[model samples]
Every structure is written in C-alpha cells, then in structure tokens.
Target: MHDRFARSEWFRNDRFGLFMHWGAYAVPARGEWVRSYEHIGTDDYQQYVDAFRPDSFDADAWADAAARAGMKYAVLTAKHHDGFCLFDSELTDYSTMHNGFGVDVVAEFLRAFRARGIRVGLYYSLVDWHHPDFPVAGDPYHPDRDKPTAEGIDGHEPDFDRYLDYLHGQVRELCTNYGDLDLLWFDFSYGDLKGEAWRATELVRMVRELQPNVLIDNRLEGSGGEKGSIITAHPSEYAGDFASPEQVIPVRGLADETGEPIPWEACITLNNHWGYHAFDHDWKPAKLVVRTLVECVSKGGNLLLNVGPDARGRFPEKAVEILREVGDWLADNGESVYGAGAAELPKPEWGRYTERDGTIYAHVLEERVGPVALDEIDQESIASVRLVRDGAALGMAKAWMAEGNPGLALVPIGPDEAFSYPLPDPVDTVLAITRRSAPEG
Candidate 1:
C-alpha cells in the first residue's frame, strides 16, 4: 500500500540507495567545498568554472555502475547554491545547457537511470545567489552571505515576483520532464519568506498532481514542513512519509539501545571527501562498506551510500573497483539483505541473525570452535540448519527440551576442513537457515 508520498514497500524493502552530489561546483576538484573555500566570491570561483569541462561525462556509464552495484535508486543534485543548474532552466544563464557542457544533465541522467531500472530523485537547494531579486546587502551580482537571499516583496529593484515565476517554471520543468520523479529532496528550509510555504506547497502539489505519486522531502515546509505541508512551512509538524536520517546510521539499528521507532539511512561517502579531490585516495575497504550496510539494516535503516564522480562524470577508479567487489558479495548473499527485517538474534557468542520468510539468516559475526548453540527458539520449528558460506552442511550435534531454554546444537561437517579454515573477515558472514514448519504459535 501507499503511505502518503511513498510506497510502504519501497520504504521498508529497499535497503540500499545511491546518492549523487554533483553540480557545476564540482568542477573545482576541491569538491563542493569551493562554496566555503573561495568564501562566496563568484568572480574568484569563476576561474574554476571556466576551466570546468567534463569531456568524458557519460550518464549511461554512471547509471550502469549504479545498477551493477545493486542500488535501487539514485539521487542527483539538480542545483546546488552558487546558482548553477544541472537541468535546462529558463531562469538562469548559469546552467549546464548554456555552459560549455551544453547538455541537460538531469534529462540525460533520468534517461540513463530509467533505462537501467533505477528510480531517480533530485536534490534542489533553496538558496540561489545569482538572482538579483534575491535579498542581499551588496550588489545583486553576488550575495555576500552563502545563505539564501530572502525575498523582499516591497523593496527590490529587480522584480521579485519574476524570481518566483522562474522557480515555479523550473520546478514544473523538473517534475514534467523527468517522467515520474520519485523524490524532490529540498535543502535549506529554516529561512523562507511568509508566502514561501504556499509557494513550496503549490510547487509540490503541482508536482504530485502531475506525477500522481511523487514524493517530496520535508525541507519544503516553512519551519515545520514536508512537501505536503502548506507553502513553505516546516514539515516537522507532520510525520514525513519516511524518516531520512543523514550521514550516520544509528549506532544500534533504527531503535536506540532502548527499542523505539526510528527509520533511518546512513549516507556515507566512499572516501573522506564527497566530490573527487585528486589527492584523496583513501577509500573505505569493501569489508567496511559491507559491515556498515549490515549495521544499518540490522537497525531497520537503509544504507544510502554516496559516491562522488569526477568532473568528467565517471566513477573514480577507486570507487568503481571497490563497488565491484561489494557487488560480488551482494550477488552471492543479497537474499539476507533485500526484503528482510531488522535482525533479532538470541544472545550469540558467535553470530547475528536476519529474518525473512520464516527463516532466520544467521550472519556469523564470530565463529565458535566446537559447536553452535541456538537457545530459546523452538527446535521443532527449525527444519534444516546449514552453513551457507562454503556450502558445508551442519548436522544437529545435540538438542535438549527445557521449558526455559529449549536448545539445539549444530556441528560443522568435515570438521578437519572447517577447523583449519579462517572465519570470514570482520564482515558479517550470512548463513541461510530455513525453518521447519514456520514457527508455530
């Protein structure tokens, strides 16, 4: 069923997503850090802009990599401050279409992603430094502060209404042109003028009317808003269709150590830097990436890992290589992740478990020496127990029926081979174990 803006299945089942933070600003190679690094000076940053040319930018290639990585959706920055648009916008001359890149970035990405069966989401920042109608202390050519230039209805030389018209036109273009967008994630919502709420509401409403099932993020709300809220009010007052926890996944799963409701996602970058910084070679090992995903899903959260491409729009060689390694792991063990619920394992000196379809997938976090003990769960419910990693079958070594601690033990077959073998690295080792008769009441 549908939950307001997003499908419940999409919210729960999609355990992985790819987040792309790309814009004209990435041209500097120092990353989007140029916004603060150059200290809001347009003329100074323009040097990097003029030299920005992505000759090898290929949307299809990026989309293909994402698909191979097992990402269900990809979110791209439609426009990040510095006022440059990735899509063809009627509002500004500083866009990919007008720039040397002379291509509709969003349109091309949408086509590539859709062809690869990946859903598309756009990230649009609320602040625009280029617009003259945008309130500022200095010349309209550039705002001194990086914050959005508030709209002043009565006191601006350039028509403020025209700016809103431009915003609306571009938003309409985004929703309609993208063919059924999945998300319009807005950023920087704490500051918007009085009517901004209405404007945002109308914009999102218009988008929903067009797509009928599009989802909008909460930043569109004035101070307490989500996209469905009345014009620019903050959507916090309303429960968003889904909670988007950024940067960090809860240390434990969705619930804190004390069990509570918290749907979240961990948006971590492959390296220390988000955008490709030529000097930043540090990449999170595939093992770390896999472990992070396990921790997230164990807590009822999705892992929306981010990978910043170079200005040429190609996945950095480091990122691509690591992704392929992770993909191989996922290809072999995806069933334990996709369409699964937060793990509920008994106090195990050895492993953690993820459950789906009346089966408990034991992800061996630790390998015990002699025997594996499973307590509390009814033994009659366990149809067959096996070790999945190396195709070794586990035979029932012992079982005891006690009212308090009903127990079963599984022993490794070919103990000579198993004993000598090393356990899977720090990464969680997933072992698929089917239940006997589906846990009887």
Candidate 2:
C-alpha cells in the first residue's frame, strides 16, 4: 500500500512551520552558506567546532517559541555538510553532545516539540565531508571540502566501509531514539552511485519500518533509478507529501500544475543570511515577516521561517522579537492562513487571495494611484467584507459590483492625510471577505 503524504492530516492542516539551522558552525557567526562558498581550510573550519559551546542551548524554549508563533512542526539539522551530528551518535565523535556541548540536541528538541503538540522533522544532509567514502565531493556542482574527495577516498587512512557503517548506525539511533517523527527532510544526493542510492533507500525503508507514520522528502530519489530510488524523479511534476519551495517566495496567489496549488512551504531566513553572521545585523522587520507569511499563505504555501541561534544556542533578540510580533499577528487572523487554499482573485493581479471555509482573505500589497480595478468578482460567493485588524465592515456590498466588473473603491480608513494606511491598518491588514458559496459564474 502506498503511503500518501499529501493526504496526511498533519501536513495539509499545518500550513506554517519553523526551520532551525543551529549547529557548531553557527559559533563562528560567519554563515552556514560558507561551507560551499568560502575557500577556508579544514583547520580553520574545525576551529568553530572547538568554540561550539552553547551555554544557553535550550531546546524547549525554542520549541515553545515556535508553537507560540503558530508553527505546527519544526525541522532541525540533524547532520549538516560538516558531518556534525546534533545527537549522541556513536557513528562519529564529531557530534554536538561529544564535540563540546554535551547535550542531545535532536532528542531534546523532539521531546520538547512533542510536548508542545508539534510535529518534529529531521534535516539530514547526504553530503558528508568527514566520510572518506562519500563520493562526488570534488565535482564542480558541489565544492564543499568537508565532502569526500576522489583522491581522499582512494588513499583513505580510515576505511570507507567503516564510515558508511557509522552513518547507518547514526541513522538508526535517530529513528529509534525519536519515538516517531513526522518527516525526514533529506538534502543533497550523491548522483546515482550504487552505494549512495542503496543507503538512501535503506534509510527510508528502515525509518518507515520503525515508524509507519514517518514521511520522507524528494531527495530520497536520484535522477533515474540508482541506489536511492524510493521516490519518483522530477518531484515537482510527480507526487510528494509537501513541496519544499526554498528561498524564493513565489509572487502572491500562484499555484503549481496539480491544481491543488501544490502543498508547499517556503523555507526562508530572518536575514539574508541563513546562519548567524557577526556583520549581518540587517534583521528583517516584523512587518516584513508578517507580509512574507501573508504572501506565502495567499499562494496556498506554508512559511518555514528559519532562525540561526548563536553559539550560546539562543535565538538572537531581534529574531525573537520579530517572531513574537508575528505570533501576535497570527493570533488575530491566522484563520486566513492555516488550512487555507489559494483564493481566486477577481482581476488576478490587483491583490492576492487566501481562503478557508467560505471566507476569502484579500491581501492588497500593491499601492494603486487611482481606484482599484477588477473584473467583477462572483458576488454570489461573497457574504460580507471586513477588515481583519479590527473586524470593521468594509460596507462594500453594493459598491463591490461595478459597471463591467466588481471593482474595489479603496477609501483609506486610517487617520492619515494622503491614504489611511492604505485600506486602514497600522501594518498590512488582511481583508477577511466572508463568502456564502464557492466561486462560480
């Protein structure tokens, strides 16, 4: 029997999640984007390992904050390109618990998140730099020195087979220790090598066998059938549990070919930097975060906003503050986001739409010089329009329908002289347009 992830209640209902990328690497405060970009030597990179002492590392606090921010699940880096494990794994001595911070991070997070009634997802990177057996490291596409090089593999002092054994052992420990996980978010694939493919498939199978409810990502499969071949190639066209749209948040109110708008989550960072950077103090404003969430939800996608805790294992004050602000916004109008589908816009460009039940939440992001034009929305579906900020009726029942189409007469309601906060809210206020029926001509 095929285990369909898209149909899973845990995934569809949870349209907002959190992604934590804290590790020994964050100690340097450079950025996690360095593993591939920076031409730093192994000795220098390893220095961060020694300095990775997270005195304030509190997994419960992180999980609690995530739950407060309306997040349903959290994905943490179990193992990154540096081959560092966040848990107590016998596979490698370069784990968080053994390295310096003697704490089982993954286990701690899992327990705390589960306690808060939130699902936990593990982010495991297939590209291991410490492993002598891991191939395709020196390739132009992937230039991480931590990844195994061809020459290093051939003249390896430590046995390659032994490394693979250790890797599998750690995987076993993670699955076995975590009771039951919601997702295994795998990153990077070593082409179609027999060994790599075999290990990936075996891992998926093993995880599922242990926890039948566990979900897997697209990285489990290679281009064509090789060792790692459980999922289909070209995941966007094919099927999967959730569409992991990285970095770039789509223009508002767009969808994939599946017609279901493709169950997606935009994994973005607080700053432009994914990891903590000393020089990068340009933290995104709380308003921008709210806008990002609103935009993602409007497109029927989840927002997995990322945060890189410092070496002390605590989120930056700026990040925390913004998250709290986002939480406050969600507390009031989350109905427009959670479990909502991409709503149909009247003109398809004036604004974006997100729907739940019979309500259509319109997000007007663009500033219009004249009156907001639209090709008359299906008024039969609309019940009433109200501002989400203060629940004020828009009084657009008759005005909603124009000559040719239903155009919006945006009378700025705030106390501003020019335009009242552009549709009357301090920040970006969602218009909760309640509808009576589904959209139809």
Candidate 3:
C-alpha cells in the first residue's frame, strides 16, 4: 500500500511556514470574516474592492520577511471566503486584475517565495459569497444567509451545480496556471456543505491529476474543528493529505486508529485576526511564537504562522519585528526544531522533548532548582550533553539533591553541581543529549 503521507515528507521536515491572508478585506482594515460577521451587503463590500489599491506591495519584501523568520514554506490566500481573487483568473472579472492594482498577486507571491527556496501554496476558499450560484439563503456562513435578497443579491433560483463547475474550474486554473505547487489549502466545509455537496471527490481527483505532489489539507472532508477520516483506519477519497487544526493545537497531536502518526499542522495567527486589522494590537510575542513552534515540533506537527498585511500591502511593523526576533532565535537553535519529532521518552518536567537521529533535544522552558532530571533516560545511554544555542558542554552527575532517587539521571546547570535560577537562553534553553551507539555484534 502506498504511504498516505509520502508527499508530506517535506512538510514534516519543514515544521514552520508563513500563511498570508490578504485581499479586498485588507482594504477595510477589518478581519477576513468582516462581511459575514457584520452582515455587510455585497454593495457595501464592493466599495472596498473599488478602493483596493496595494501600490506599495512588494512580493520580494514579503518573501524576505518569511525567510528571515526561518519559514521554509508559505501559503497565500488566492481567493478568500470573500471570493476576491488575488490571482489573474480568466473566469472572473472581479479579481486583482480588474479591481486592485492589476498585479497577479498569487503569481508574484509564488515567484518571490519560490525564489527564496520557500515552498509555496495557495489557500482557496470553498465558500464564495460573491458567486451568484452559491447558496446564500439558508446557508450556514453566508452574510445574507437569513435574507439573501437583503444583501444586494437579486433574489433568484440558485444553481449549485453551476457554482460547483465554477469552483472546480478555478481550482483547475490554480493547478494548471501555477508551475509546481507544494500545497493547496482549502478554506472549509461546514454544516451540510461538506463532502459531495462541493463535489469534493471530483475536485480532489482533478487536483491530484494536475499536482500529484501537492499536500492538501483535510478541509475537503472536515473543518478546523473536525479532523475527518484522515485520522481513521480508512479515509475517504477526499480525506486530504494532512489534518489542519486552526487556532488551537491538537492536545496530543493526531494519530490514526492503528496509532500511526498522522500528518498535521496548526494554523495560528500572529495576532488575534487572520486579516489585517488596523486596531488589532494583540500580537503574540516572539517568545510565545518561538515556544509555540517548539511545542508543535515536539508534537510531530508543523506550525503555519500567519501575518496579515495592511491595505498598502505592507506587513505590519510589529509583525516584521516579531518575525525577525524569531529568526534570530532559530538561527542558534534550529537543530532542535527542523526535522525533530516527539522523543521516545516521556514529556520532561522542565519542558518538551524532541528527537532526531538518536539525539534528544530537551527544550528547557523552565529553570529547575537542582540538576535538571533527565527522567526516563538511562545514564549509560547518555553520551554527551550540551546547550543547543552555544554548544557549551553541561556536566552530567548524580547531584546530592537527587540522592534519594539514585535511579534518576541529572545534568547540572552550574559549577559544583549547583542549579542556576536564570537559564542561559531564557525563552528556550535546548539541551542536546546524544545517545551512545550500541555495541557491535
């Protein structure tokens, strides 16, 4: 049997990526779901589209920021739920080509990120409120679902099959027009709009044919909250390649019925909102971002962090600063993150444990009073212990404090087996533990 997660090899290794949510919604300076949240009519929302002019947009700058943030991949919102196309879609006149500064945003993004060796992906929202054939009244997330006629949409009999054709056609355009995509992130499936309601199987088949190696998220069969059959013994045809958990990380990561690890990623925003909100100053600190990334890596999952660019196509200054700080930290301790997964040992009391190639990375998030106990690790198996940031050798000894527990293996943080209060790297002081090789037969 083919490995269901074979295509996710790169994704697993990457472990960190950038997710950009930019479109006409950026013009409003509100979140991406502003229309649905505030019940804004199509006519009122069209004004932002008319005013959308990202003249200061520089794709290279965006790519540079991601690279500096140590992100190995990126995904841009080609067509968000608002149905505004960032790419040059021949099928639609309501795109950047017709509305915004006439630049093919998706194409530029792909080129810039690809140039920087960042694997590029596009986020296509399955829910398009602008499309006439798409159901409005009685639909779950539509702005005018309660009163379709009230939202500047002329009341008419909607043909969902026609909408599916358009959706499929646009997906095809994305697959064909883009040279080689590494991922295709679908927005969602909620209420009764999931599975065949969007002709998901057919759409997935077409995508697979066009981009065989592209990693697809589970949204085709599930949403952010629902993981779908991807975590089951037998997944559906449209089960997708990876579980996409949004906003929150999985408590224990994801696994199949057989206990095999399932490929998963946590899509988290740098701030509270996905789209650029001028007043949303609630940005996550660089320390939290770094620790969050380490947590994801330790759980055998990737972290696709988001940055919502403002209307002028510039990433918020604070976002850039935070990313730079994260990059600075990654520079010294990237070995503990990239290609690292959950260690065979249990979670350490100090922090988490990630392993790669028999080397255990003890991410010391807290400072312990005595020699940090390397629980569940045998003293004979330990070859060497060193700090990941500076490669300073840390002494391993059975400190007198742990005399009561002779079986415990401890690594002292200070001279004479004394424990230090403040760790060298306060955010995450990673200790690299190399396991001794087995005797030759």
Candidate number with greatest lDDT: 3
Residue pairs clashing in model 3 are none
Candidates' C-alpha lDDT: 0.65, 0.67, 0.89
TM-score of decoy 1 = 0.82
Cα RMSD of all models vs. native, in order, equals 5.1, 4.8, 1.5
Write one digit per residue (lDDT tens) for candidate 1, span 309-344. Answer: 888778888888888878777877787778776656
TM-score of 3: 0.97
Q: Which wins on lDDT, candidate 1 or candidate 2?
A: 2
Ranking by lDDT: 3, 2, 1
For model 2, residues 37-56, the per-residue Cα lDDT tens digits are 77544456778887887888
**Tens-digit lDDT track for model 3 on 1-441?**
139888899999999999999999988888999999988768789999988888889999999999999999999999999898999888899899998478999999999999999999999999998888888777767888777383325776678898899999999999999899999999789888999988988999999999999999999887887989998887999999899999998888888888889889999999999999999999999999999998888888999999999999999999999999999999999999998888877887789999987899999989888678888887778889999888999878754556777656788877867645578788898899998999999
Candidate 1 residues lying further than 4 Å off, grouped into runs, are: 1-6, 135-143, 146-165, 191-198, 221-239, 252-263, 344-351, 372-378, 388-392, 399-421, 424-426, 438-441
Candidate 3 structure lDDT: 0.89
